[model samples]
Target: MGMFERTASVFDDAMVLDEEYQPDKIRERDEELEQYRQALQPIIDNRPLSNIFVYGKTGTGKTVATRYMIDHLQEDAEHYDDVALSITWVGCENLSSSYQVAVALVNELRSSDHQISTTGHSQQAVFNMLYTELDKIGGTVLIVLDEIDNIGSDDDILYGLPRARANGYIEDARPLVIGISNDFQFKENLSPKVRDTLCEAEILFPPYDATELNSILYPRAEKAFYDDVLADDVVPLCSAFAAQDTGSARQALRLLYLAGKRVADNGETNVTGDHVRGAKEELHQSKVIEGMQKLTTQGHAVLLTLASHTANSETPVRTRDLYDRYKTVTEKIDADTIVERRVRAHLSDLTMLGLVTVHERNEGLNAGRYHEYELSVQLDSVLEVLSEEQRFDDIVEIVKQQVHGMDRT
Candidate 1:
C-alpha cells in the first residue's frame, strides 16, 4: 500500500464530532456569551428573571448561546432550594394552538426524567396537569420557546403563561420565559399585551465578525479535524461568506465540515483552499434548491415558472409580467389559484428564501420604485430538478414562448 493509504488506515479522526456542537467549546463570542449569561443570571440565582427576546438573522449562534446559558442555569439552579428551576423547551412551529402547546408541555414534562406525569389526558387536562406539576416543583420555571414567532394562530400560550406566574395563579412557581426568534418583525406584530410582558429584557445577538468566527472555528476544528488539516484562511472565508446575512457560527461550522468532507472524499489527507471553494459552490447550489423545495407547492410552482421564464427571456422579467405567465400555466394545469396579489405573496416568500432577488428602481426621487424579480440560483440547476417531472416539456415550452414574446415586445 502507498504511504497516504497507510495514513488513511491509521488516521480516523473527524473534524465534526456530532450534529450539535457544544457551546462552551465555541470560540470568539466571549463578550456575546458573557452578556447573554448576565441577562439570565438573575433567574439562575432565584431572583426574578425577565422575559428576554433574542433577535438576529439566521445562524448567528443566538439559539446556541441561549441553550448553553440555560443549560448552565439548570445546573446552577440545583444548589438553591429557593430557586426551583424547571425548564420546558418548546418549538412554536411544531404546535399551532394554545391547546397544542399545553399538550406539548404535558408531553415534554411527562417524558422528562423529572417525570411530571404519565397518564393520558385531554389538552386542557394536560395543561392543568402541567400547572400542578409546576406548582409541585415550585420556584422559577423557565419556559424557552425556540422560534417563538411560529406560535402565531394561538399565541394565547405566550400571551397568558407569563401573566399566570406574574398574577399569582400558579402561587408557587415563578415562571421566566426566554423567547428566541429569527423574524425581525416579530415584536412589532405581537399583541400589545404580549409585548408588554415578553419585552421585559431584550438581547440582540449580532452576526459574528471574522475575528470572533476564527475564535469559534479554531477549537471546534481542532476537536473535529486532525492537527493542521485546515489552513488559517478557511475560517475567514467562511465567516465573510456568512457575515452578511447573520454572522452564523452554525453556517461557518457547516461550511468547514463540508469542506473537510470534500477534501477527504477526493482522497486528500489535508483540506485546502480548493476544497473550501468547491464546498462553497456546492453549498450555494444545494442551499438554493433545497430552500426552494421546502416552500409550499404553490411557491414551488411560482419558482418553476419564474425561473423558466427568466431563462427563456432576453431581459429580466417584472412581477406583473410573471403573473401573466403564471396565470397561463395554472390554467393549463387546471388548478384554481388566487390572482396577482397572492402571486406577489409567493414572490415575497421566494425572495425571503433566497431563491430569487428583487431589484427596485424609481424613475424619479419622489416616485416610489417598482420591483423586478431575478433568479438567485442558476436557472438550469432549478430546471434540472424540475425536468425530472412529467410536465417538463410543457413547462419548458411555456417559458420559451414567454421569452420570445419579451424579445418581440
Candidate 2:
C-alpha cells in the first residue's frame, strides 16, 4: 500500500457542515425567514423596492437565511410577467471602505472580461460605474452587502445606492441595498440620513440557544455522519459548548465536524464528549494563534511586554508600568515608540482579542479609577508566536531571562 493510501472515514457529506453550504431548508429560523420573506414581498408585488438591514452576531444564520429567502424570492418572482429581478451579493469582510465596497460590487455585477480595476477610480467615479452596471441590469436590483460593518463609518455608498433612482443616478434600475452586519454599533453609528434610507426594513437574527443548536445539528449530523458513528452525547456536548460560548450554530456545527475529524484521524469509530472537548481546545488555540499572527508589529510589541511581565510574575500591571517596559522593548529593537495613550489602545484591542484581560480599579473619590492589564493566554503561546519574528529575538530572550530569574528567586 502507498503512504497516501485511502482509509475508511466517517463523514458521509462533510460539506453539510461547511460555512458556505446553503441547506435546502433553514431550521430554527422560521421567524427570521418569515420577516425576510415579507421584506422581499414588495419585489414580487411589483411595488417599490425596500432597502433592508440585517443585524446579527456571527454564525447566527443571517447570511444563510438571506440566501435562502433570496433563492425563494427569485423562484416566486418568475411567476409574474412584468417582474424582472437581478441580484448581486458582495461580501465586505475584507473591503474596509465605501470605495473598496463600491469597486467590489461593480466587479461582482460585471462580467469577468469587463471587470474594472479595484483602484484608480475616484469615489464618485466608482459610484458612477456601479450605477451604470445597475442600469444595464435594469429592473429590480437587489445588492446584498455581507459583513457590511467592515466599511466602518464611510457610508456614502449606502446612502447613495438606495436612492439612486430618485437621485437620477440610474433611470432604468430600481436598486435597493441589503446590508448585513454582525455589529449592532455599526447601525447605531450610521448617519441619520443614511440609516433612514438604507434601513427601511430592519431584521434581527438573535443567537441560537442550545436547544435550537441541537435542532439544527441533528439533521445535519444525520446527513454528515454515517450510522452509529456519533455517540449519544456527541451532538449535545458540542451544542452546549457552543451555546455557552457564543450561541453560534456555525460554531456548534464546526465543533461537531472537528470532533468527527478527530475520531477519523485516530482510526476510531465513535465520537464522544471527550472528542468534542479536545476539538474545542484545538479550535480555540488555533484561533488564538491566528489572531496573534495577524496583529500589527506594535500590537505584538505590546503583547510581548505583557508576556515579559507575566513571566516575571509582575502582571496585572498598570498602563504606566507597561508603557515603560514597552518603550524598553521597542527601543531594543530600534522600533519607534508610540504614546502612552496609543499603548492603552493596543491593550484595549488585545483585550478584545482575548489575549489580554483588564481589571478596573476604583480608588477613593480623591483618586480616579484605573485599569490593570495582564496576559490572558498562555505565556509560552504568545512568546512562541512572537519569536517567529527575527527582530523580536532580543526581547524574547529578555522575557525568557525573566522567567529564569523568577525561577531562581
Candidate 3:
C-alpha cells in the first residue's frame, strides 16, 4: 500500500470491523436462524403460520436473524401468484400506540400513486382501512413487530392481527404475526387472549456461546481488517468478554472496532491485548452516555447529581442522602426543586436506564428497607454528553477509584 493509503487504513481498518459495517445477509447465528425459518415455513406453504414470539437479551442476534428469515421468505415466495405476501415491519418504540401503528401500516401499504389519509381518521377507521388494504392485496400478510414490548398497547397490535383473521375482515388473506422483545416479562404482561394468539410458536434465542461467537466473528474480522493486523490473542479475548455479557455479535463487533481504534489512536502498528482492554473501557463509557441520553431532563439531572456527589465520595450514598444532594443541584440550575417523592421516582428511572444500580437492604430489628445506589458506568462517561457544567476531569479519577478501588492522589 502507498504511504497515504496506509495512513488512512489505520482509521478505516477500525471502522470496517464495526457492526455498522455488517451486511444484512451476514449473521453468526445458525440455530436461531433455522428456527425462525421453520416458524415461517407454514407461511411459505400458503398455510396460516402461527404467530411467533421471539425473546432474547438485546444484541443477541434476535432482531437480525428474524429479519434475515423474512428476507429469504420474501425471495422464495415469488413462485406462487396465489401466495401474495405483504410484510410490514414496525419498530414499536417509534409507534407506541395502536392508532399510530395502524397509521404507519396504512401509510406503508398505500402506493405513491394512491393517496391514503393517515391523519383525521378515527383509530377504528384506520384499522378498518388497513384491513381493506390487506384484502385489496388478497394474500397472506406477515407483520413483524420488533421490540413489540415498546408498544404501549402491545395487545392492541398483537391480539388485533389474529382477531382480524378471525373476524373475516380480510376474508381471502391470512395474517401471521411475529413479535420480538428483550423484556422477559413482556409476554406475562399481555392479556390472556393476546398471549394465547401471539404465542402460537415461541422461539427463544439464547446468548451466543463462546464457540459460536468465535466462529461468527472470525470471518467478520478477516473481512474488516488488513491481514495479520490484529494480534493472535485479540479476537479470542473479544469473543470471551462478549460471550460472558450477552453474546451479542453487535457487541463483539463494536468491541473489535474499539480495540482497533485504541491501537490506531496510540500510533500502534498492530492491535494488541492492551488495545482490547482499552476498548472495554471505551465501550463501558459509550454505554453510560447512551443510557444518559435516554433519560428525561429530571432523570439526567438526578444521575448527574449522583455522578457529582460520587466524584469525591468514598462510598455509595444512601437514597435519602442522595436526595439532599439532588436538592442542592436543582437550585444551582434554577430548576424547580423536586420533592423527595419525585426524586425517588427519578432515581428509579435512572436505575432502569442502567445508569445507576440499587442495592436494597432489610436491616435487623426495627431497621426498615432502604437502598444504596451507585453508578453502573463511570461518572466521566456520562458527563461528556450531559450539560457541560456537570462535566469534570475529577470524574475520570472518581470512576477509576470506584471501579478499581485505586488510590489516586
Q: Higher-TM-score candidate among 1 and 3?
A: 3
The digit string of per-residue lDDT tens for model 2 on 12-58 reads 88999898788888999888888898888889888877899999999
Model 3 clash pairs?
Answer: none
User: Which RMSD values do the candidates have, in order?
Assistant: 6.2, 3.9, 5.9
Q: How many clashes show up per model?
A: 7, 0, 0
Over 1-409, each residue of candidate 1 has an lDDT whose tens digit, in order, gives: 6655433511244525344655465455577777777878887565666778888777777777777888887888788776667778887676656677776776666645654333355555666677777787777778888887776645677776787766666888877778888887888878788888889877777778767777777766776776776777876787666665457777777777788878766777777666777778888878777776566656767877687667665236777778887877766655566678899999998888878888887777775667788887776677666655555557756665665676787
Which of 1 and 2 is the better model by lDDT?
Answer: 2
Candidate 3 displacement at residue 161 in angstroms:
2.1
Please provide, for model 3 over 1-409, each residue's C-alpha lDDT reduced to its tens digit, 9 standing for 90 to 100: 6555555444434555655454556455666677777888887676656889999988777777776788788898997776678788877777677777778777777887765665688877888888898888767888877887877445676667678878877787787878888888888888888888888888888888777778877877787788888899888889988988878877877888888877766777798877888898788767767767777767766876787667667348788888887787666665677789988988888887777888988786777888889988766567666654443234434444664553454
**Candidate 1: where is the Cα deviation over 4 Å?**
1-19, 43-45, 111-126, 166-168, 291-380, 388-409
Ranking by lDDT: 2, 3, 1
> Candidate 3: global Cα-lDDT?
0.76
Estimated TM-score per prediction? 0.74, 0.84, 0.76
> For this target, which candidate reaches the highest lDDT against the unseen true structure?
2
